[model samples]
Target: MKALVLAGGSGTRLRPITHTSAKQLVPVANKPVLFYGLEAIAEAGIHDVGIVVGETHAEIEAAVGDGSRFGLRVTYLRQEAPLGLAHAVLIARDYLGEDDFVMYLGDNFIVGGISDLVSSFEQDRPTARIMLTRVADPAQFGVAELDRNGRVVGLEEKPEVPKSDLALVGVFLFTAAAHEAVVELKPSWRGELEITDALQWLIDEGHRVEATVISGYWKDTGNVTDMLEANRLVLESVESRLDGEVDAASDLIGRVVVEEGASVTRSRIVGPVIVGAGTRVSNSYVGPFTSIGANCAIIDSEVEYSIILPKASISGARRIEASLIGHYAEVTPAPDTPKAHRLVLGDHSKVQISS
Candidate 1:
């Protein structure tokens, strides 16, 4: 079987950052989210892969290259617009050919890869298989309604009135039979060919469509909150390793990884934290669940549960928590000498002043 990974979506939810970078390329634990999916596909023994890319195709190509880095031969499929998931399958028809394939969303993070899922699909050989997880807001995702026997009976895409809390996870297994369903689909109300519709079509036509309600950790890292949470979860399993310099003045607590060329002086780093290669942390407090990207500088600041992208600097900042700082960004204290209030307020804008 092959793999089709979708890496093309204008991530409006992660604006300003996504404005400059592809959402899939956003780092979790200093590794690109897209890389995780690719690695998982490789681990599943799928050597032939096709990556669906959009406007950031060049960037994705540069980052992934020939995919040899992930032990897979990747073919890049260009999607001109942000069409629906079904449309991605439609465009990848040529690359997918007659083989069964797995469709994975690049920004989604699933703990303990999809090897078992692939194994099950190979064994059971269902026409289409979807992974579902119980979510708080089913309306935010494609939801599946199972019958009394836990068989998938109904599927809806972002329904206003959801029939079930089982939301579709980003991983899907499909045989070549799915091509017949996707081709017969019409654009949904949202002006895109929904994948949920394709699966529904298979069910309507007497094809075997299966669903698995997964209890494992899965996250669609589309927004900032989810990104930070996924980073925290990944960091939890990190082992303590010090390949870089940690001066006597520094105190490194549990499970901290100071990567090669990184230096820590007069700083205190708590557990499950990773300081990327060439990063410098001096006179700072690096708390838990933090991943500081390569070449970053943190001086006289305190940061926790945050992701500091490559080349970003946080100096003299009081504290930062649960934040996603973009690459090459700077976080420094404002000028203290000019403490007087300045007014350039906009209409209907609310401001809080410390008096």
Candidate 2:
């Protein structure tokens, strides 16, 4: 089977950051979110992969070139616009050809991988198979309605009143039969061809649409809260490895990974935390679930549950929690004499002030 990975959405939700960097490229634990999906696809033993890319195609290509590094031969398919999932399939018709394939949303993070899902699809050979998980806000995702017998009976895209709380996960398995349904779809109210509509079309045409309700962790990683949660979840599995230099005055606690060339001096790091290569943590308290990217500087500050991008620096800040700092950004305390708040924020920026 082949794979189709969608890396092409303009992440408006993660604005400012997404304005400069692709949302899929956002680091969770110092690794890009899209890389996790690629690794999962490779683990599923699908080597022939097609990546659907949009305006940020150049960056995606640069990050994942040739795909050989990930044990797959990737072919980049250009999507001229931010259409819809069904539209992506429509454009990838040539690349997908007649082969059965899996469609993975690059921004989605799923624990336990998709190996079992691929194996099940290969054995059952359903016309289409969708992964579903119970979500608190069903209206924010494409939801499915199951019959009394637990069969998929209806599907809707971001319904005002969802029929069920079972939201569609980003992973999908489909046979060549899905192509016919995709071509016949009309634009939804949002002016894009919805994948849920195509699946409903397949169901109406008497094709078997299988649904699996997954119990494992699944997150979209589209917003800050979800990204931080995903980072925390992934950090839980990290093992303690200290290759970098740690001073005698510093204390390294459970499950911390200090990459080579990183240095910790007179600081307290409470894991699960990762200090990326060439980073320095001095006279600071690096708390749990925090990822400091390469070449960053953390001094005289207290940080917890945050992601610091590469080249970012935080010094003399009393407390930093549940935050996402961008690349090359700096965080410092305001002058006591002025006692004023100064922020040079971008569009769609949301800041919370604590007095």
Clashing pairs counted in every model:
0, 0
The reply for model 2, stretches above 4 Å from the true place, is 336-355
Query: Can you give the lDDT of residue 126 in candidate 1?
Result: 84
- Over 4 Å off in model 1, which ranges? 335-355
Pairing residues by index, what is the TM-score of model 1? 0.94
Most accurate candidate by lDDT = 2
TM for candidate 2 is: 0.95
lDDT (0-100) at residue 214 of candidate 1? Answer: 91
Tens-digit lDDT track of model 2 for 59-131: 9999999999999999999999988999999999999999999999999999999999999999998899999
- Per-residue lDDT tens digits of candidate 1, residues 1-355? 9999999999888876787789999899999999999999999999999999999999999999999999999999999998899999999999899999999999999998999999999999989999999999999999999999887888999999999999999999999998999999999999999999999999999988888889999999998889999999999999999999999999998999999999999999998999999999999999999999999999988889988788888777667778788877776666543322322211122333222
Worst 10 residues of 2 by lDDT: 338-347
| Residue pairs whose backbone atoms clash in candidate 1 | none
lDDT for each candidate structure: 0.89, 0.91
Instruction: Highest TM-score: give the candidate number.
Output: 2
Ten residues in a row with the worst lDDT in model 1?
339-348
